[model samples]
Target: MGRTVRVIAALGLAVLPGTTAHAAAQAARPPRAVAPALTAPAAPALRRSAWTGTWEAAPSGTAPALPGAAIRNVVHLSTGGNAVRVRLSNRLGTAPLRLGAVTVALRRAAGPDAAPGTLRTATFHGAPTITVAPGRDLLTDPVPLPVRAGADLLVTVHTPDDDGPATFHRQAMQTSYVARSGAGAAQDESGAAYTATTGSWYYVTGVDVRGSATGSVAAFGDSLTDGVGATTDADRRWPDRLAEHLRVRRVGVLNAGISGNRLLRDGTGPSGLSRLDADALDRAGVRVLVVFEGINDIINTPGPTATALTDAYRTLVARAHARGIPVVGVTLTPYRGHRLFDAAREALRQQVNTFIRTGGAFDAVADADAALRDPADPQRLLPGYDQGDHLHFNDTGLLAVADTVGRVLDHRFVGRAAGVRVLR
Candidate 1:
């Protein structure tokens, strides 16, 4: 038997300042499950305020499973809290994924060393060990710890036996460690046992913290949002930069980007339309959704038209509004020298960007194209920001994109989102 794991990417769209971009047509597909505009969920329980997303890496694809081997994923946080919890998924597994041990702790330095007195074992349903069924998600009970935002945390997982494909997020950009022995060393705080290193995040999907921040912002899109061009372990992805800006305000940012992903169909993980809820809308304390994608859709084979892409944006926005979560759209940036660049595709990109800016589909707009494009030639990426790939941005380019996003989701936007409604 076989299963298909959808690769979801972000759409390159934008919202006008306190105004809606209007598009009248069946451009967008029929609302699968559209949410009302500017509505947040009703009065909530303690759990509602108990957890806010600090970090995330959307599962991009599966890899061969490693039984009896322990995996330690080094992750960075956007915000910290009093208590923390981890979420693991087997959504793409063909068989049950067994956990022998799981641990979370603050990092002492870089490598795999855990800070003293901070290592904590994770439990599911009060049990230290449990089986995560295929196509399912499980959350570890919250551990009481002082989690500092902008810090690194080590989430280590050990499997006693191989089950099926290992659900993982590729392009972690950060290095992780693996222990080949049955000891897994998952319970060890020392780095000596973890002799091997890997670039992808395994099993572990998200990290959430309780207290400190009231809500978070989800950065949804493609490789640009995923930090493809950023330095390893530097946390300089545009989303990471945005998180730094939001830190002072106590807001978290989640980066959910799938490289080579598209908005209309699955290529890397799941299509853009299929991942909105998991990547953004449904996340803990998610108040805003910002998207920057669609280059793949335009440059890839048999790409989507401006109309098709815009309709998809409208559908995504409608669903977000129904849940009372405000959507912020970002225009696509320039990519002139890329291998896939072409005149027709470039024209399509421009058309889609126009709709994103003036189509009345979003609540706020960030002109990423204008911010990162060369004034001498609007079609080309600014020389300072180019990651050398023309398509992706370097650290400087990442910062530029971050500035564009922050300019729109500024204090005024944050204030309005807070009072508009609670997210459902």
Candidate 2:
């Protein structure tokens, strides 16, 4: 008999900022003081817990097609949060955008299972809001919030924002619709919290607690792992599915994938290497890390740059390891006949994959390529799992990626996921 151990990777997509060439040059500062020492003793054998969830905003009607601001799944917190982090996007925008008064409050309940009308309020570094420029991501200064898990929170924004045709992963977990000013979500209640408005319009994608996490995993990579082209509102992104897997086994998963992102240079989103802190490491309770990146570096960026890409990856691996957190390298999936197919690019991908397979620098490695590649085509997605784009994965494809990592983390795939503890 076979056993399943679900595994979750807190992956971030390629979130690029729309900074001007001049601004980027000026803003580039040295790596912030080697991230404060997060030295923890060998992790105890403990079960997992649902720690945090991600949320983004969807564009509303007549909302200026801000090049990078058309984000789907905006999030709001209510009732039980103190210190919260808001995700400011520049993923698809062309120029840097700035945000002003971004507020969080309780929305009125609109359903049978609604909580209460009045709820707790959140602070932006004890102020009202902070600013996030394009092509760049920012983490707000932690604020003392008082909220619990599963509470409804309202995240509001008003600013001189740029717009663009952004890409979003639609899922059913808990995303809202976006109107001009309000996110069409159930009104949040405090005393009698329950579901109210059934169908909401704001794209309030995700909201999660920051207190319940034991540790986190950063699954950084391109679209194949990011769950692109999957059903909207299904939450079928491999990371989402992985989170469910973690719930069963007692773990926390954070999704940080951006479509069209690369490891070496910028692609559709910000370069994988550049968005590390915002996407993965900087979170309060981060522990393990899984890097499933580099496909874009090989296939999309400057050709025949495998050596440079490898060197950059080495730097990334070294940085994470220096922090005492284990870094897991995932092999790149094959892209045999996509429009960007190139023999040279394919060669670079194979080289990087080879390094991941044999590179001892990584605490562990997941052979993601073997999990989804066709036995015959080898370079193309396995039959029945392709999203038809030949670049990204379908729901089935996402599951395959999850399964591969699941098995790599723990011999089991379900019932008892990675970091599981069986109580007698």
Candidate 3:
């Protein structure tokens, strides 16, 4: 009845003496036919939805205006994507700021010019040009520019109107190019027209890219986090180094540090508490915060106590937790030999660090003090890491701090879906 039995009967093979009837029948049957192979389905296309902050510089103060001139700012991106957008600020400008043109391109090197065939023009609401009012920021429409992590982007803006007081980040260690009024170099691929160089970033504040990343981490601190003592044009800041360490991971590192920034009151820039929302929380896809402030408040300012500073830290932690982003507290480094160092300030620094280490207030602790402090003279920085200022770290010190932070982040976030609230 079955196919095998029919084949065996038709073949007429004799049954062996030792073999069973089923085995003899199967041996006489013809081979079975094989089924045809199947084709696999094509993979679905990925959707472009999430965006991350690839590069950022918190606007600290106002820079001189570039009336009828083109200014090009070079920024280092922490993550790459298929499309890019830029955030420009007139936060300190007195009058409306008008722009004639705006362009973004991938830089071939550290200089002003972009690589050929990689330049792209950015638009705002489908318009080529826009006017930004005082105390406001404008985000350009997404431009199709493929970028790799750690790529340097040259953003050129042509200002036709007199921008009164340009909102800027004053401590950009990297050099940027500028063309005078008569020299229009916004679209120049060869950087020949850019004659002047500056160390500040004007107008542009942040750059966001569409990518598959979990989110970004904002380094909220003062000059040490701002890369003050690192060499010019070298992306050796602790946050820059952290970005490099996290390039293969799905995370972005944004440097929101302002030189001389204080945690308690306004100083070189807005206080850490005042600008936390704008600088850290509101950034594109920011998931974590790292606070390395309070040194300036303890040494340079008055009316700050250990209790007050730790209370301020508590406030920062609470605020970030409300937005579902964890905060990592960094222990302040030693500054015993600096001009501002005093017994009272050193005592306060020790008290605050004790609380940071044992109080269980922050979600994580980076222990920067232990990493950079001298073993012989615990109240001062290690001789090799010190930049001679006693307060800031050199390139080597910066790398050490970055490595510690990177390890902490990796242990907390990588390969884990749920966020961890506390890390020693």
Highest lDDT model number: 1
lDDT minimum window of 10 residues, candidate 2? 1-10
TM-score of 1: 0.88
lDDT string for model 2 (98-156, tens) is 54444445434432222343333333445544433334443343434545433344554
Clashing pairs in 3: none
lDDT of 1 by residue, 286-375 (tens): 778888889899999998888889988888887777666677889999899989999999999999999888877877778999999999
The CA lDDT at 389 in model 1 is: 84
Better of 1 and 3 by lDDT: 1
Q: Rank the candidate models, highest TM-score first.
A: 1, 3, 2
Question: Which scores greater on TM-score, model 2 or model 3?
Answer: 3
Question: Which 10-residue window of candidate 3 scores lowest in summed lDDT?
Answer: 34-43
Which candidate's TM-score is highest? 1
On lDDT, the stronger of 1 and 2 is 1
Question: What is the model-wide C-alpha lDDT for candidate 3?
Answer: 0.78
**Root-mean-square deviation per candidate:** 7.9, 10.1, 22.6
Winner on lDDT (2 vs 3): 3
- Ten-residue stretch with the least lDDT total in model 1: 14-23
Q: Assess each prediction's global lDDT (C-alpha) against the native.
A: 0.80, 0.49, 0.78
Per-residue error for 16 in candidate 3, Å, reads 90
Q: Give per-residue CA lDDT, model 3, range 1-424, as digits (tens).
A: 1212111142232211111232233223332221111111111222235788888898888977888888889999988888899988776678888878889999987687789998887877677787776766667888999888888999998888776888899999999988885235787787878889989998888999996655778999999999999989989999999998887665679999999998878667777766776677668787778899999999975659787788788777766665566777899999889999999999999999998877777767889999999999999999899988898889999998999888877776555343422111
